[model samples]
Target: MKFLMSILLVGLSAVSCAQNRVSQTEFKKLMKDPSAQIVDVRTSKEVAEGKIAGSTNIDYFSASFIATAQKKLDKNKPVLVYCAAGGRSASAAKDLKKAGFKKVYDLEGGYDAWKE
Candidate 1:
């Protein structure tokens, strides 16, 4: 039972460690880099409100989310993703990882946080 518990903890840790989460400050720093691909995973309506400069909109709810991302994003380069409040970006980061993206950075508090 102890061994099983240990394995479970390790598995959970691995999953959490798979993606990097950054604060608004860290995300802003990353955005300054031209190589980093900034992706806004908010809905089109939300994006129309306002978004981080240089971020490309990719609706998380889109039917071709993954396919569109693959075509628009660089798999080898760093990717910075954010949503309205953070939840969607975290999920998007996981999908980005499974798609073979080397480095995935999720905005800690999403675009709302970025504004603050």
Candidate 2:
């Protein structure tokens, strides 16, 4: 049925995105490479609460996410994005890929997980 097919498509999309996420250890190793740009996609308020060091804040929910990301980074370079938890970062990673970023990564558990 069409409904079943739609569900299947959505499931597949989520799976593909999940496959793109990386663990905190992997993220830390990537940071050591220095070729990666780490991004925090949480809101200003969220950042005020606390954030991972070396991350640049560019709220994913903002109308200017695309513009801010463009200004803060080179579209061709590798970028790592994270939010308070994993949701927003995952969303941002998808957008970055659509925006022509060749290598984009999202923190699996986010800052909350990192802080622990």
Candidate 3:
């Protein structure tokens, strides 16, 4: 019974910690919020080509990715993350949540989707 309860609690915690995945339209609307911190979790080279205006570049592949993000972002504010095509950002969002971010959002289909 105790083991079952523990498993249930763990499952509930996982569900609560899941990051929000937003479509381009929802992402755009959320971006309008002044307090939202937009992060591009792409390589520096990829970011150089183009990125959302006003977003901060924090390479997802960096060894200190989670630590850098924790230092750079405010825990209280909403964080909006994107990658080239939704892959890296999804991973980054999970890391952000594990690092104690209360509200983390991933851009579905990433920059490609937004550009379309």
Tens digits of per-residue lDDT for model 3, 1-116? 99999999999977764538888888899999999999999999999889999999999999999989989999889999999999899889989988999889999999987877
Rank candidates by lDDT, best first: 3, 1, 2
Clashes of each: 0, 0, 0
State every prediction's TM-score relative to the real structure: 0.87, 0.84, 0.86
Candidate 1 lDDT over residue span 1-116, tens digit each: 99999999999988775548888878888888889999999999999999998899999999899999999999999999999999999899989889999989999988888787
lDDT of each: 0.90, 0.89, 0.91
Better of 1 and 3 by TM-score: 1
Best candidate (score: TM-score): 1
Better of 2 and 3 by TM-score: 3
Evaluate model 1: give its lDDT. Answer: 0.90
- What are the runs in model 1 whose C-alpha is more than 4 Å off? 1-19
Alpha-carbon deviation at 48 in model 3, angstroms: 0.6
Residue 8 accuracy (lDDT) in model 3: 100
Q: By lDDT, who's the top model here? A: 3
Cα deviation at 30, candidate 1, in Å, is 1.3
Error of 2 at 112 (Å): 0.6
